[model samples]
Target chain A: MSLPHAILTALLEKPSSGLELTRRFDRSIGYFWSATHQQIYRELGKLEQAGHIRALPAPTPARGQKKEYEVLPAGRAELTEWVARSEDPKPLRSALLLRMRAAAVVGAPGMREELRRHLDLHRRQLEEYRAIEVRDFPPARRESEPDRLRHLVLRGGIDLERFWVEWLTQALGELER
Target chain B: MSLPHAILTALLEKPSSGLELTRRFDRSIGYFWSATHQQIYRELGKLEQAGHIRALPAPTPARGQKKEYEVLPAGRAELTEWVARSEDPKPLRSALLLRMRAAAVVGAPGMREELRRHLDLHRRQLEEYRAIEVRDFPPARRESEPDRLRHLVLRGGIDLERFWVEWLTQALGELER
Candidate 1:
């Protein structure tokens, strides 16, 4: 449900071909809302049919040609309406924590190794987010409304990865003791 | 997927009727993984059919009878295997962050109110976590492995609420500027 609206928002920011949207999702939108390329393409078709979005004329007519898309006025209105609606916060589903709970019951054999694996993964992701932060939102940069908002989203990712690294370390320490 | 495993974990901790399981989920399991009462009943039926769980014979039988469930040895083995498997950490999907992004483009009318509401909600949750920490996890008490694991999960909730409160405060400050 949110995915369609997310796509609409992205297209409103910039008209993009399906391929371009897929790449953008991997780099940006994927940070918060991940979608496989197939899912994105399928949603694009739905949005086009629903009158929320429209495909630009193909430069070359072909069966498998990529098509560009832009949000219609309806899409913008829908996004605006959706923005104003209040949504309840849902608790994030964490597989690691669930495993921890299960490990407590079944005995945490081999779990220490998995916890360490998670630690390494989070560390790499933390570095990746930090590199992005340094590259994109350097000091002295004039921030626009959209830029500031995007930076906040990036901050969410950075903070979350840091939390994981910290918590996983604590877990490992506890497991070893 | 994880829901069944979570149910298994809870059942292993204590055998409970379906209705009891629903209430437990709203309090404890609900912290990390949430499920509606209907989903719980449906999964209970499936789990029974799959031989992972079995319904305990009731002393009295009648319409709308409450059914108790217990995990079988097969269920315990399955949960143990699941606990040891490596799982990829999912990207945290946040509707609030999505709303913030949409607000940046669509104009955030009335969004300040929502942000303030989130702040208060998180504040209350943070306090509740702290209270639990003080009451149950008092440092004077010696801890067992299960106790420590539960505490770690509690810490996850506490840390996450703290993060939200901090981030929301920062976000509100930015909005006011």
Candidate 2:
């Protein structure tokens, strides 16, 4: 459900073909939200059926060809309504935490390695986010509304990666002790 | 599923009936992992069927009668295996982030208020986590292996709440300008 809205927002930002959306998702939206190509294609079909989006005119509309989509007025209205609605924060569901709980019962053999892998992954993600910050926002630049909102979301990812990297290091240190 | 493993770990800590498990989930386990009562009941049944756990014999064998369960050795082994298994970190998927993305397209009318609500919720959650830390893990005390692991998981919850609280405060300040 949110995927459609996410797609709608992405399309609103700039109309793109299915392939283009997938590429954008891989780079930007994929940071916060993720979906497989199959999932994206499926949602696009549903959105088009629901009249929230439609394929822009193309000369050769055939299989494997580009199919650009733009959010309809109805989609914009829906997104605005969703933006104003209050939603509860989802419960934190970390598989790592569950593993930690299980590790308590089963003895933490090989747990340190898993933590290390997570630490490395987070470190890489942090680097990617920082690179984006440097490239997109840069220093000493006036930010537009869209830029500010985008940066706010980016800030969350950066902070989250920081939390994981820091926590994992401490956890590894705890293991050593 | 991780929920079943989480259940096995909790039951390893203390034998509990379905109702007790639900309460525990609501309080502690629910912090990092959550489940509906129906989901709990279903998992309990499956775990019992799979020989990971069994009901403690009770005098009254009536419907709705409390049927306490305890983890078997098989369950412990399964949990240990799960702890050692390497899982890719779950992608970050905050509906608030999604809404924030959507807001960029449609003006942010009620975003500040939503952020305030989230701020309060995270603050309360942090208080609860800290209270647990005080009650369960007082200072200058040697923690058992299990206690340490549990505390590490709790530490994650505390830090995450702190992140949200700080980030939301900063985000609100950004909105003012």
Candidate 3:
């Protein structure tokens, strides 16, 4: 449900060929709503068939040329409706946490190392988000309404990673004790 | 994979009939790794077939009598191995955040109300976690090793809910501006 809206948003930001959309997902939108290239391509076809988007005319019209797609008015309307829809926050589902609880019953010899590995991963992710903030949303820049919302989304990623980093550190300390 | 392991851990805590197991899942394990009653029952059957767990013999064999299950040595061994297994942290997949990003592209007239609603929900969840912390893991209790590990798991839930409360509050503030 969210993937189609995610694709529509990306298309609205900038019309792109399927390959370009996949690249953008790998870079930006994927941070929040991840989709594989195959999923993206399949969704692209669905959106086209739904008349939510259309392939733009290629200047050269060459065979095997990449087809760029732009969101139709219907797509924008649907995205707007989706944005305002009321949905419950999804419950937490973490295998690591579940494993930790399982370790309480069965002694986990390598569990500490696993926690350390996750701590490192989250720390690196936090640093990456911080770098993006510095590069893209410096305090000096006057942001538009959309920029503000986009920055808020990035902050969500940054804060979530930070939470994991801190929690893992605390868990490691408890394990060591 | 995790569901089966989750069931093993719960059974190890205490041998229980399927009905009791479902209740426990709804109260405690559901916080992290949620499963429907049907899924829990299905997994229980599979575990019994796998010989990782067995139903205790009833004093009187009666039709529709409840069957209690306990983890066998093999199940304990499997759970031990699983706890020590290396698993990558699952990447975050938040539909709410994705919707916010979509809102950035399309004018979201009711988006602020949605953010506020989420903020309220998260705040309530955080409070619930805190109440559980006070009731279950008081400071003066001299916890056993298993208790310590269990408390750590509870802390993970508490911290995670706290993260959502703070992040959602921040998001709502941004939306206000």
What are the DockQ scores of the candidates, in order?
A: 0.72, 0.83, 0.80
Residue A94 deviation, candidate 3, in Å? 0.5
What does the lDDT read for residue B72 in candidate 3? 98
Among all windows of ten consecutive residues in candidate 2 chain B, which has the lowest summed lDDT?
A: B138-147
Worst 10 residues of 3 chain A by lDDT: A138-147
Count of backbone collisions in candidate 2:
0
Give lDDT tens digits, candidate 1, residues A57-156.
8879677887889999898999998887877787768888988998989999989999999899999989998999899888644267667766776787
**Candidate 3 lDDT, B1-177, residue by residue in tens:** 799999999999999988898899888988899888889889999999999999899898686788899999999988999999999887788998898888777865798888788878878877888888888888755267677888888888887777777887887777777
Candidate 3 lDDT score at position B52: 98
Candidates 2 and 3, the one with greater DockQ: 2
Comparing candidate 1 with candidate 3, which one achieves the higher TM-score?
1
Model 2, B1-177: lDDT tens digits are: 689988998899899999899999999888889988888999999999999999999998999898999998898888988989999998888888888878877888899999999999999999999998999887544368777877888898899999999989988887778
Backbone clashes in each candidate structure, one number apiece?
A: 0, 0, 0
Q: Chain A TM-score, candidate 3?
A: 0.94
Estimate the Cα RMSD of every predicted model relative to the unseen true structure: 1.6, 1.4, 2.1
- Of the true contacts between chains A and B, what fraction does model 3 have? 0.85
Report lDDT (Cα) of residue B166, candidate 1: 85
